[model samples]
Target: MNLTVVGLGLIGGSLAKDLRSKGIAKHIIGVDKNPDHCNKAKELGIIDEFQPLDKAVANADLVIVSVPVNATLKVLTMVLDLIDDKTVVMDVGSTKSEICKVVENHPRRKNYVANHPIAGTEYSGPVAAIEGLYDKKTTIICDQDKSDPKAVLLIKVLHEAIGMHVIHMEAEEHDRHIAYVSHLSHVISYVLGKTVLEIEKDETNIFELAGSGFASTARLAKSNPDMWTPIFMQNKKSLLKAVDEYQKNLQEFRDLIAGDDEKALYNEIGRINDIRRVLEGLALKRAQGN
Candidate 1:
């Protein structure tokens, strides 16, 4: 298969590397607006060749787009002009509702599969991509029923081959769930990092006092702001709702601490602990393939 990965950033580069490593695609090509990214992707062996968008899509059996949320619709519009009925186009953007709505009425919408693989790190660029990055990850396929059956099946098979478990979801539902889980986490991390930097202006010595808890919580702050800014904007309504809820929870905890309500604080912490238990159970289930 001739596969073309557009953007050549973290997700796109990772996909190209995995597809090539697994021998799933005979020829893997890459497309990127940034010449540096193209050169780096080629050097990293992520793709066999780098070409212009038109030529890449024209010759591709599968086209995987991994760009920012705001850029997704535009890229899809351009790809649609070049792709044929047999070509399978998939996008790995964080936000899906807007993109899905934009392409809903397009004549060749069946060739497009909207996918969000729940995997990534606080990094970007082709150099940051690693093999097996998508392995054991849960990939959400939004509005699969709206896509062509063969195209959807091919995408599912590809994701499975790359060690991802597929889950079907409506675009709106995916946005809502990810807002709380993924988007809200990034918001909190960014704010926390800002707060800490304000207090400890000395970046060199701040790490001496920072423990594992702080390190873990602030890890997402290192993520690419360019990518996240558009995602937060695209899902503004859902993200705002999530932030409001988080603020309310934080205020409640503050009030408990102020009043020295030991029992209430303990109970609240215990309830959250239950969430950890639930997550641990889910992890175990996934490991056992249950």
Candidate 2:
């Protein structure tokens, strides 16, 4: 397949690397607003060449829009408009509802698929593009029925080629579930980092006092704000609800701690501990490459 990647950042560059390495995509044409990223990706062999968006998508068998959520709205539309009937396109935006809704009535709507691959790290740029990032990860293809069957099949083949498990879902449902599991966690991480930074002015003290637990919890705080800010805004409604619930739980825990209700606090901890089993199962599944 002749693939065109709209953004040569982590997601797009990673996808290009895996697909090219696995022989799924014959050639990759990169398109990015950043010339430096495009050059870096080509230097790293993530993409074969770079081109303007119009020229890139024109000859592509498939185009992957892996830009930020806010930019994806415009890029995806441009890709669809430029591509021929046979050229399929997919977007890797985290929030799906807004993206899917905006292009629902487009003339080439059937040529596009909405995807959110449950993979990534607190990094960006082409240098961060590594092979096997999608290995054993879950990718949700939202509103599959709305897209052409051929396009959907091609997208499934592309993701599955990179060792990802594909599942179908509605766009709205994907956003709601992702808000709690993904978005809320990011909010917590960023805030946790901010809290620590504010309270612990001494960098040496933080480095000495912090353990692995703190490091892991605050890892996502290093993620690119350019990407995450748009995601938070796109799913604002669902994220607000998730944040509200999280605040309520935190309040309950604080009240119990303040009131010296040891039994209630212990019970709450015990109940939350049950998540360990679920997390273990998930970890096992990923380890086994399910």
Candidate 3:
């Protein structure tokens, strides 16, 4: 397939690399607002060449818009308008409901598919593109019934080629679930990093006090704000609810600690530890390339 990737950052560049390696993408044309990223992607062999959006979409069999959530809706609409009847367009934005709602009545709506690939590192740019980044990951295709069947099948084939499992659900449900599973984690990480930074005036002593646990928890805080800020805005309602629930749980823990309810605190910690089994299963699946 002749693929055109709209953003040559981590997600787009990574997809370009895997798709080419898997022989799913015959040639990739990159389109990025950043010329540096486009040049970097080409230098790294992530994309074959760089082209203007209009020209790229004109000849592409598939167009993947991997830009930020705020930019995705506008770019997707433009790409859909430019695409021919046979061409398929997909976006890998974090939020889905807003994008879906905006394009619900578009003339070429059927050509577009709303997708969220549950994969990434706490890194951005073409240099951070890993070869097997999407391996054994779950890609959610929201409102699949609204897209053309052939386009949906092509998207499924593309994700499967990179070792991802494809599932379908409503766009609203996808937004809600991801607000808790993905967005909430990032929020916690950002807040945790801010809290630590506020306390650690002596940066030199931070590393001495920190360990793997702190590093792991704060890793997502290093993610690009340009990307995350838009995601938080797009899914504001769901994200607020997630934040509210998280605050309630945090208060519960605070109350337990303040009231000297040692047994309650211990039991709560033990209960949360049950997530270990689920995480282990996920790790096993990824390791086995399921």
lDDT per residue (tens digit) for residues 1-290 in model 2: 89999998899888998998899899999999999998898899888899999898888998999999999999888888888898999999999999998899999999999999999989999999889999999999999999999889989988888999999999999999999999999999999999999878755476677899999999999999999999999999999999999999999999999999999999999999999999999999999988
The lowest-lDDT stretch of 10 consecutive residues in candidate 1 is 281-290
Error of 1 at 244 (Å): 0.4
Task: Count backbone overlaps in model 2.
Answer: 0
lDDT of 3 by residue, 1-290 (tens): 99999988889889999999998899999999999998999999998899999999998999999998898979988998898898899999899999999899999999999999999998998899889889899999999999999999999999998999999999999999999999999999999989999888856577687999999999999999989999999999999999999999999999999999999999999999999999998899888877
Candidate 1's TM-score reads: 0.97
User: For candidate 1, lDDT tens digit of each residue in 211-279?
Assistant: 999999999999987799999999999999999999999999999999999999999999889897778
Q: Tell me the spans in candidate 3 whose CA falls farther than 4 Å from its real position.
A: 202-204
User: How do the predictions measure up, each by TM-score?
Assistant: 0.97, 0.98, 0.97
Cα error of candidate 1 at position 226, Å: 1.4
Residue 68 displacement (Å), model 2: 0.3
For candidate 2, the 10 contiguous residues with the lowest summed lDDT are 200-209
In candidate 1, which residue ranges exceed 4 Å CA deviation?
A: 202-204
Q: Pick the candidate with the highest TM-score.
A: 2
Report how far off residue 235 is in candidate 2 (Å).
Answer: 0.1
The whole-model lDDT of each prediction reads 0.91, 0.93, 0.93
